[model samples]
Target chain A: MREFDLLAHVYRSNVDLPADVAIPPGDDMGAIRLGGQTLLVTVDQLADGVHVDLATASLEQVARKAVTRNLSDVAAMAARPVGAVVAVSLPRDFGDTRATELFDSMRRTAAAFDCPLVGGDIAMWDHPLLISVTVFAEPGEVEPVLRSGAQPGDGIYVTGRLGGSNETLPDHYTHHLDFMPRITLARELAGDAATRPSSMIDLSDGLARDLKHLCDAGNLDADLTIADLPLSDGAHQAARRTNEPAWQHALGDGEDYELLFTAPRSPRIETADVPITRIGTMRPCAGATPAILLHLPDGATCKLADLPSLGWEHHA
Target chain B: MREFDLLAHVYRSNVDLPADVAIPPGDDMGAIRLGGQTLLVTVDQLADGVHVDLATASLEQVARKAVTRNLSDVAAMAARPVGAVVAVSLPRDFGDTRATELFDSMRRTAAAFDCPLVGGDIAMWDHPLLISVTVFAEPGEVEPVLRSGAQPGDGIYVTGRLGGSNETLPDHYTHHLDFMPRITLARELAGDAATRPSSMIDLSDGLARDLKHLCDAGNLDADLTIADLPLSDGAHQAARRTNEPAWQHALGDGEDYELLFTAPRSPRIETADVPITRIGTMRPCAGATPAILLHLPDGATCKLADLPSLGWEHHA
Candidate 1:
């Protein structure tokens, strides 16, 4: 069992808590109320060898990616980034200059997004460096766009193209360049009344897998058209060279950090600056065999239910 | 060089932050602003073997100690506790009941001090179980008590007896009793209107070492009277069995987590339930000499400056 399961078994026995906790434990982030404002708080940890190879990645890049990973969660909640606290466990070998570079990058990133690095902790450990960042955002009650909000008759839209993360893994993973532009664009669209989507989630864990989450949580099914998939040239070329299908790369690859949302059809919404493509439609659950029905470019229709979930799994 | 030193260099070179960060980059905690209120935020990480021995320490006690350590920091500032966030990195072998007990103990202690556990992160780590907690508190304007605030005429006062932590270490290290009450009492006493200590600190690094810190920071010297020292029976017994003086235990034993403050003599302040002992008075800085002067019962004065600083050092 996971540690959370153990925690639930031990502490969750007594369920008495104040009404301020809107979204309690066991979610991507916890939500609470403060003076009519809904606050979203989430934390993410990046270990040296497990999350990044520090020998290859610059401290600046490591710092930016650390904050961006949490920012992606803020985007998931459709919340404006407010502030963050970073706690770091450092190996004794790391010098002062490298540590400073990491903090500088974090401060710049937080400031660039108008979020402040409020507070944190620093300690020495024998283990590889662990950087954990907790981000807090003030998301006023405009209805938190959750995974369970997808509905039948809703059109699926994905912001930005996919599969490029692998071909340009260094740029996507190290520099954190790919996520910034996409997140900025997504946030702009989310803020605009004309382009606001009903339900939105950042596609960090690939299109096919994350779609299954949205569909499963909403108790609906998705019919995705493979022909309408938006694939990056780099991703397509890399997949071709590797003898892997470009569609599979676009469908199953993770860390894209792109927004995937479903909203009712609206013509006034412009997709000029934002490179969003219409991919599919939500439908009532059909058969027990397939919760997500994929309409291939070929005549074949594949069932996504029996497929294994993609992306990173902690235990696996 | 340490990772924190490197972090300081990077952050210093990269960007210009807001003006309110009084004690930024290095120190026990980072201080920031919240709508004109000075908020002190600090995080401390306790790993299984590094900070506590999980083999002997109960998970509940480990969790409580982890939070109490940070609470001691809030007490150091003479600030009231506001809230906290706890992030836990669990080894895969950790059971569910342990996680529950950990969270339950943490939540109870947080509530006991009126500082609720707002949110946190839980992840799986391969080696040791790491628990990091970040605490927040509002700084008092008149006396956001710091180590540097002591004056030459200031009299040093310590709340409660010292050296009892070693005797209670069995119960505390085993998770049989709560340490939050002692911490709360210290914080409450530090902020008491009647006392209004000029400079204050929490005694984690033993009385002699911590007094040296206060004296060094304030550019003054301190003389402690051995006769005025408060000794618990358990500490006295332990010292006697070890063939050592009981006063040494009261003076130099660490992990006391008591409040050590310096204030001018005040008629309004009288004795209360918590034991308050006038141990010493600050004097002019002796050039190239002792920062803390200990007056023993033998009538000979010994300099604490020559002694090695006590308590847990990350590198040591």
Candidate 2:
């Protein structure tokens, strides 16, 4: 069975959603009322073989990736990070030298985001190295954004280039571990209530899959123009080497820790810090089968189901 | 490299503690300031083979153990439980039915503690099953009882019995996973300024090892009378079977999930809900060689270094 299927079953049947919980499972971050403030928390894991090739990747890269990936969820809700706690189980052969490096990297990366490493657990065992990071963040001046707020007329925008996260990495790295989490940009977008996003999510599981998440959450459909997809430099280079269109990689290549948000209109985004590309629009679902439609550069239209599932399948 | 040594290194050098963090790593739970409240959080994990024999243990037992272990930490701090989030990685052979049982057990246990399961992550892989639980709690009206507050003249008290956690279980089950987390009892003691505990910790790694934690955190020594140790019924039976002193098992067997605290004096403990035993007293350190000293029933005193280290050694 798929990982999401198991998680969805657990979320639907098992969890007892208390009244204090503002956001539930299946969101970027689950939030609860903490005294007078709202606290948003999320936990994510990166396994040695599943998320990265531990042989080639450094302990620092692995540590940074684990922290940054969780921070991406913090940014998705436009929440101000408080701090984080980490839990790691290292393989038997992993030495203390690498462990020291891992913790150092985690400290540095957390400090960079103004999120300190307050607590953690570490153990050595026979299993592959696994890192689980749980982050705590506070809602910004405005209410935190949810993925279920998108409307029929909202414009779909992305913060940075998509795809190529798997392409430009050096031999020692699996993906773009150095990429920023877009925390500041999301906060800026969230500061203004009129221009704030109706719904938002981080692109960790490809454009198509993540778009479907947004659509399903909002009960709407996504209509996108393939030509408008923001192709990263690494995406173009990989497309040339692999003899494929850059847009295909842009759509399917996951690990892009960029922001995909739906706004009422192009909300006066400046192209200084990060590029904001309007690639699509939200529409009312017309049929049961096709929830996501893409207009091709060759004057053709295709449903999301028709496209080859080239991105990473978590279970596959 | 022992597990404690690795953890001590991380606690000593790795974490970057900020002003907002009241309690750092190496405690039952770390505390941070959120708005006007102090939030105490902790995350702990249990692996299949390392913690339980998955071949004989049911998935429900595994799930319950993971959540209960974390709630015990909350009880140590006398914190009000807000909620908990769980992360699990399942082995390839684990079936969907078993997964359902695991989640349902986790939910029921969390709710019993008034800590609902708000979110979680589940994955399937080739490794043995691993479960990590992160719990969030807030301090009561009074400040949380810290491990560093033990005074030289304080009396050491323990709630419930200890030891023999390794015995009395069926071939498939673990030390009773149904034990309650002393949340209400700790909160009652914390609410009163006069009768509150000077320092506290939940018993997980045996009385000897965890007592060392309290001593090290407070920079003091503990003098315990062996005869006064509250031996569990399971401990008595197991000691009879193993031809060992019941007190030996009482002090060395881990996973008791009991509360051990140091108060100024025997503070009018109500022994109705749970048994309270005044085991010993805290004292000033006399020497550097032995931090924990045990007075035997025969009136002979010995240092902890002279003991055989019968407690659990985590990865060992």
Candidate 3:
């Protein structure tokens, strides 16, 4: 039998609950009320070989990655993270010192981001170790910036540069390009009541694919100009080393964690601290046709829908 | 390498975060937003062969059990459950229909209890299926009913009967007994403002060991009467069939999900719908010793602390 089948058998019992539940269990994040505010919550599990390969990274790096990945979701909704709950299924060989270091690193990162680590569950698993982080954030009055809010004439923008996370790390622990810059930028932009994006989403699955998500959500088509893409130095270097087009890597590489948003054109918005570049505009959805139109630096344009879908598929 | 070591390696990169994070990830649950009406959030994961065996159980049962086990924690704290979020990791073999069934069961169960399923993360895993449910609750006006609230002269009370779960289900469904009586009597009793228990905790780890948690927390001793213990018909029958004392199972069997609380003897509050039995009285903590006293029917009292510690131990 499947694992879910087992869970269903042992856990699917009815319950008599009180009236305070706003959003119940089984969703991405269960929301409850604190006074008059609504809190959005969600938990994600990252397992070795399942979510990432541990052999290629450091313990502290992994811990930070886990926090960033979940925090990316909080950014997507334009919510300010309040706290988090972490549950770890450790292998028997795990020791206290290593656990402490892992926790300390995560704690520092969380504190740096304003969201505190609230509580967590630790266990010994005979199989692989699993790290599940549940984040709680306050949902603002603007109703989280959803992917479906883009309109036909909305302008599409991306914060920071993208691509090349798969390459080698930086020397002497200086700066890692993979670390998300959008967390601060998105919060800064969205928190300003004057500059809210019509639709906002984190680009974890690559801009090529994520832009499609934004366009598809509103049944709209997105047109992008390759010349406007912001390419990170590391990404450009990696593309050059591999003799590949930097634009393709910027468009197709996942784990960028940048914020991809759509909003009506506004000149009053400040773009100084945040490196936001307008890459495209939204149009009516072409139904059964390409959802994203990409203009090449050489004057040719291609439809993303016409290409083989890539990046990440949960099941694939 | 250990599982957690592997996780630490994969997720420990330095990432930028906000400033308010008091604790970061790595505890049983992370805690943040203290002082201004604290919120307690926790997530528990149930895996096939790990937490439950689902080969012989129904899907609905598995889903229900998954939700309640997490809900039981809220009951333990005497906190009102507000909402929950589910992160489901399913094997590819499990089709969308099966996933839908699991979610549907969860939705219906949450709705039945008044908590609506708001959002969640659904992913595919190569290993056994895993379901992580996170529960969110708010501590009411009264200070959070913590395990440390019991006083030396407080009366220790238990809600409902214990120990028949093992006998209530078919022999093949022994694990099913762990989650019976879906609705916790503790939540109901705590909700009634007039009779709220001073210190409330759910009996997930058997009455014998759990009461010790209360003793350790309150820095006091408990003199419990086994004769005053309430036993279900299934527990009695199971004892008779096994030629053992029924009280043993009642005190030692885990997964009871009943509320164990303490209160001052005044205010004379009674809840007719929920059965509550006074099983013990608290005493000042003895020097260098934290213990529980079991009063036998013969009026002889024995220190239960001398006996082997029973109930669930995650590592074990």
The residue pairs found clashing in candidate 2 are: none
When summed lDDT is taken over every stretch of 10 residues in candidate 1 chain A, the lowest stretch is A169-178
Please, what is the whole-model Cα lDDT of each candidate in the order they appear?
0.68, 0.82, 0.67
CAPRI grade of model 2: medium
lDDT of 1 by residue, A177-246 (tens): 3355344555555666666666677776578767876786678889898878888665686587777778
- Winner by lDDT between candidate 3 and candidate 1: 1
> What is every candidate's C-alpha DockQ against the true complex, given to 2 decimals?
0.36, 0.57, 0.31
Worst 10-residue lDDT window, candidate 3 chain B: B21-30
Compute the lDDT for candidate 1: 0.68
Tens-place lDDT per residue, model 3, A259-278, is 88998864144655657788
lDDT of 1 by residue, B105-166 (tens): 88887767766676666777676888888776656443466777788878888876776454
**Docking quality class, candidate 1:** acceptable
lDDT of 2 by residue, A165-190 (tens): 86644443334676789888898898
Give per-residue CA lDDT, model 2, range B27-84, as digits (tens). 8887778777788888888888777667766777778888988899999998888888
C-alpha RMSD of candidate 1: 4.5
DockQ of 2: 0.57
The TM-score between candidate 2 and the true structure equals 0.95
